[model samples]
Target chain A: MSQKTILNDSHRALGAKMVDFGGWDMPLSYGSQIEEHHAVRRDAGMFDVSHMTVVDLAGARTREFLRHLLANNVDKLKAPGKALYSCMLDETGGVIDDLIVYFLEEAFFRVVVNAATRDKDLAWIRSQAAAFDVAVTERPELAMIAVQGPNARARVATLLSPEVAAKALKIGKFVAFEGDGLFIARTGYTGEDGFEIIVPEGEAVALWQRLVDAGVAPAGLGARDTLRLEAGMNLYGQDMDESVTPWEAALAWTVSLDEGRAFIGREALEQQRAAGVPREMIGLVMDEKGVLRHGQKVLTEAGDGEILSGTFSPTLGKAIAFARVPAGAGSSLRVDIRGREVPVRIARIPFVRDGKPFDAA
Target chain B: MSEIPGDLKFMKSHEWARVEDNGTVTVGISEHAQGLLGDLVYVELPNVGDTAQAGQAAAVVESVKAASDVYSPVSGEIVAVNEALADKPETINEDAYGDGWIFVVKLTNREELEELLDPDAYAEAIENEED
Candidate 1:
């Protein structure tokens, strides 16, 4: 049997089409996916992100444990409620999972990982924490909802207590605030200004309903996928997996090899950096009419590559994708779709950013 | 949900074909097929005069989640392809039985039409598949 989120009933009640997404029974869409995509781009939308795993690390050595575990440096988060995006890799430098780690206090920190990598991530974190004495506790009792868009923060603030609302409003990007059993973070997967609220699982449905009543449109996985792709965010298994390394997957910026940090896979990354990485991930936009899709063969003068993630951008009214190609691949390439070679331009990572088209295109 | 008009013949793959008095069959993916596909973003249709065999891929429908192949229900030569889908593929989601019609095929063998399911039998076939 597939695992269902706490909002499964609410999704069905709203006429959402449910699908099995990486073992979690989740809503794929409520109605028109394009409309849902536009809602987040133009107005406000909410997503039930309860399926993602939240693990709290608590102990005197929590910070030190994370420093040795993550590819990105946790030392950058000096202040409480600050979050860092990092990838945890294995000894071979293959990405185990990409996650957001929130630094709360010296003894407590929160890590949100992908839903499909929950079990393996917990196991890996626990095993690595053996020497640090940190305790890893999965918070399955907490439910997460992401309210994103231009007006997302304002709409959610209307439902919060005055003090909490003030704190949320004042919170900067990539920051979080906790109050009254609610953890509100100014973070989101979509390239939109919003908050990802984590509340008690029992109170989640009611909060979701309140958001719905506040004119926050309920979106599903379909819109979420398109939004994330437009933002150039990587999907766990599709963009990179156990077989792929962070440096080759266009995540070299997330890796910290500055010094004094001996994290897992550091040596391997250093070695790979010394020896030039084989494949580099790039963004591709079809100049003509065609939808870029995963597994499509990318033809470059240097060598051939394949698309990692692709979709039609409702915001841009065009198709875009991230493709892994030869390191020397030029800025222009062709994609073979159903035996037709279509010209594609090798643009920068994000086709759109900050509610506008990325300047690279 | 709207009724499946009796005059239309159906394919097991969820394509509805309405045989015009002129012997050409208008083809469109069924409402059930479109509903299952969620929202279509891109559609690749066969060109006019292309030969399509039964069970062969005749068109491509891409949704936000994944791409699916629309199979030819009956063998024939493509008479017309919906050019409107090039700009508005979501028409399949809006009117799978009407404006979203994919193409028209001039039947090469009218006798092969007997292999297709009628509207009522098509509904039953779909229900059984769901079960």
Candidate 2:
């Protein structure tokens, strides 16, 4: 049986189409997916993201443990509530999962990881934390809701207490605030201004009801995927995996090479950097009719590659995809759609931003 | 619930057929199929002279989520296709029965249409699927 979130009953009551997503019963859409996508891009939308795993690390050696665990240096997060996006890699420099870490204190750091890789990540963290004496605790009693879009923050603020709203307004981008048994972060996967709020499981239904009554449209995993893709955010399993490195996944910026911090996967990355990287991820956009799909072979002048993540971008009104190609591949490429070799142009990472085409903006 | 046109024939796979006055059969997917597929972004129709076998894949419809096959409800030779769908595929979502007809086929075996489901049987099929 698939696991259910706290909002499962509510989703069913709202007439959502439920599907098994990564072993969890989650809502795929409330109704028309395109309408939900437009709701987030133009107005406000909310998503039930409680399926993601949240782990709390508490101990004197928490920061020390994280310094050696993550590819991104956590020392840069000087502020208490600041958050950093990083990838947990294996010893051979392959990505295990991309996650977000919030530094609440020297001894109390919180990390949120992908739902599909939760058990593996927990086991890895526990085994690695043996030497550092960090206590790893999985907080399953918390429910997360991500309200996103241009007016998301404002609409959500209307439901919070005045004092909490004031504090939330002051929370900088990539930062979070906690009060009244709620943690509100001014961050989201969609390339829009919003808040991702985590609350006690008991309070989840009431909070979701209030948000729905406040005119926040309920979007689902369908819109969430399109929004994140349009934002140039990579899906964990599709874009990168245990066999793929951050350099090939177009996530080299997330890796921090401090002079003295010997993180896991550092040696392999260093060796790969000395030797030239072979494959690179690039964006492909097709203005024509057909949609670009995953597993489609990409033929480049240098070599043959395959599409990692492909979809029809709702915001851009075109097909967009991320393909792994030879490092020396030219800007022009062709995708074998069924049997036809269709020409595609290489574009920048983000196809759309702020409800407009990124290239046009 | 999606509308089921009583005057037309339907296959369990969700393709609908209407026998035209010219003895050619007009084909399109049902409203339930379009709703399940979401907003279609592309439609690939069969060639004008291709032979379509009953219960075989004849066309392709793609939405943002994934691609789905549109099966032939009866054996026929493709006579004409709605070429407008190549540019404006959303017509299927708007009107799955009227302006969204996929193609017209000259029936090679008229007896195959009798083997397909009637409106009541198709409705029952959709109802049983829900359970």
TM-score of every model versus the real structure = 0.98, 0.97
Candidate 1: pairs in clash: none
The DockQ-based CAPRI class assigned to model 1 is medium
After superposition, the stretches of candidate 1 with alpha carbons farther than 4 Å from their true spots are none
lDDT of 2 by residue, A1-361 (tens): 9999999999999999999999999999998888999999999999999999999999999999999999999999999999999999999999999999999988999999999999999999999999999999999999999999999988988887899888887788999879767999998998888999999999999999999999999999989988888888999999999998999999999999989999999999999989999999988998776889989999999999999889988887888899999999997799999788999988887878778899712
Candidate 1 residue A133 Cα shift, in angstroms, is: 0.7
RMSD, candidate 2, Å: 1.4
Candidate 1 chain A minimal-lDDT segment of 10 residues? A352-361
Residues A234-335 of candidate 1 have per-residue lDDT tens digits of: 999999998889988989889988678899999898898899898988888886766899999999988999999988887777789999998899867999
Fnat values, one per model, are 0.58, 0.89
> Any idea what lDDT model 2 has?
0.92
lDDT of 1 at B38: 82
